[model samples]
Target: MTLTAADVPLKRPTVLVADDEVALTDSIAVWLSDSYRVRTAYDGHEALREFGPSVDIVLLDRHMPGLSGEHVMARLNEMSANPQAALLTATSTDDFRSEVDELGFDAYLTKPISKTELLGVVSDLAAAASESAQH
Candidate 1:
């Protein structure tokens, strides 16, 4: 039997959640696992280790130890992975908006984000990624 696109299962988009807060990282992972392939990293180094071309979205905490989210993002850019990244941070500085833009983040969300908000952003990013991939 010839398998058409409809006959094959579609691959779920991968989301990488990186935060120094262990609880937050695990919780976000659990929340996203139902809809997307979720990968959790407790630090910036771990985040880079888990990241690759397969990642469609990245939810990164801006203030991680050893290597900040900005550093990770820069490195990811160097690696040529075209994932949509969101900065999930507690920093709400006046210049944060410009910083996020300058640093190349697709979105910036200040923490204590609700599950709804997180899911919505991920869903939107995933959809955009899918659309871009088709082109």
Candidate 2:
């Protein structure tokens, strides 16, 4: 059976990985490249510039030089079709986690994220968003 474009699954999740750490961002972009059209931004300003309505999700580091994740998240939320986002941080404390969650993220993940976990979260979130959009 010859697989055409429609036959192939629609890789609809386009994720933005905003982090100053080049190595880590590259690693994630590489890992997710197969399933998602991943975009990398060095800082918040770049993230804002690169981000658009087409993006499905944003995986932003809590800390960065130009703009903090919190600030970026707020800015993103102001958009018409706000993209689903999650804070990936090494500083995942109970209080901090709760606070970030309260700000309303699809998920909050810790640093050193396993490939399996990242894939699962991205997949589930994308599926849910697709379903919601369809309705």
Candidate 3:
């Protein structure tokens, strides 16, 4: 089926989610389908390959097979228009939070994140993206 403008989540805000967990990727993609143009990548290499450098946001995991979350965030920051990213990890650490933020992820959501929180965050990001577009 072709996607209409109304079908696109966050309007023009395309989001990329890169993680090694297939289940997590599928679940997130399903949850976010109604509101965002969501894409998934199983690893950092795939993330780099698939993610538009101009993508609006990314939900990245802290650990993966080859390239760590830190590494992906590092590379993203080097882009001219760095996409906003959030860390999703089952294990929460203050040190990790510090490190993730240093890489400029917009937020760090602990894993097992609720559907409500995910929707809410996406809503906020969409609004932010809209406002930015107006300016």
Candidate 4:
């Protein structure tokens, strides 16, 4: 018996979620774990430590002790990683849209994000990333 290409399982996309709030971080990880390979970091520094080329998406809290999400995004940029990144913060979109655009985030979502919204955005980002990788 020979295995065909379709017989092999596709690799799940990896999502790195970083937030200073332990419960929030854990919750998001749990929500995404069913569809993706999810990694959680409790701080910006830990986020950076966990990041690598294999990460397909990033969900970062805009404000954290030690290092902010902005700082982590900058570091990821410095590393030349192309993962789609989202700023998931309590900050209002009106106050942060320009900054989010300038910082090169692929998407932005305020805190209290519903599981449906989170999953939708991640699914879109994952699809985009996969499309880009193929070209």
Q: Where does model 3 exceed 4 Å of error?
A: 1-10
TM-score of each: 0.90, 0.89, 0.84, 0.91
TM-score computed on alpha carbons, candidate 2: 0.89
Summed backbone clashes in each candidate are: 0, 0, 2, 0
Q: How does model 3 score by TM-score?
A: 0.84
Every model: Cα RMSD to truth: 3.0, 1.7, 3.5, 2.3
Residue-level lDDT tens digits of model 1 in 1-135? 799999755989999999999999999999998889988999999999999778999998999988998889988888877788899888684676776677678877788989999989888898889998999
Model 1 bad stretches (over 4 Å):
1-9
The C-alpha lDDT values of all candidates are 0.88, 0.83, 0.78, 0.89
Candidate 1 deviates by what RMSD?
Answer: 3.0
Could you give candidate 2's per-residue lDDT for residues 1-135 as a string of tens digits? Answer: 888898777655789999888999998899899888888998999999999877888888889888988778877777655677888888755767666775567887788888889888888778876776677
**Over the stretch 1-135, how does candidate 3's per-residue lDDT look in tens digits?**
999878754445788888899998888889998767788999988888877745778888888877877788888777655666688788866765676677887777788889899878867766676677677
By lDDT, is 2 or 3 better? 2
Q: Residue 32 deviation, candidate 3, in Å?
A: 0.6
Q: Supply candidate 1's per-residue lDDT for 121.
A: 88
Task: Name the lDDT value of residue 16 in candidate 4.
Answer: 96
What local lDDT score does residue 67 receive in model 4, on the 0 to 100 scale? Answer: 90
Instruction: Give every collision pair in model 3.
Output: 9-35, 9-36
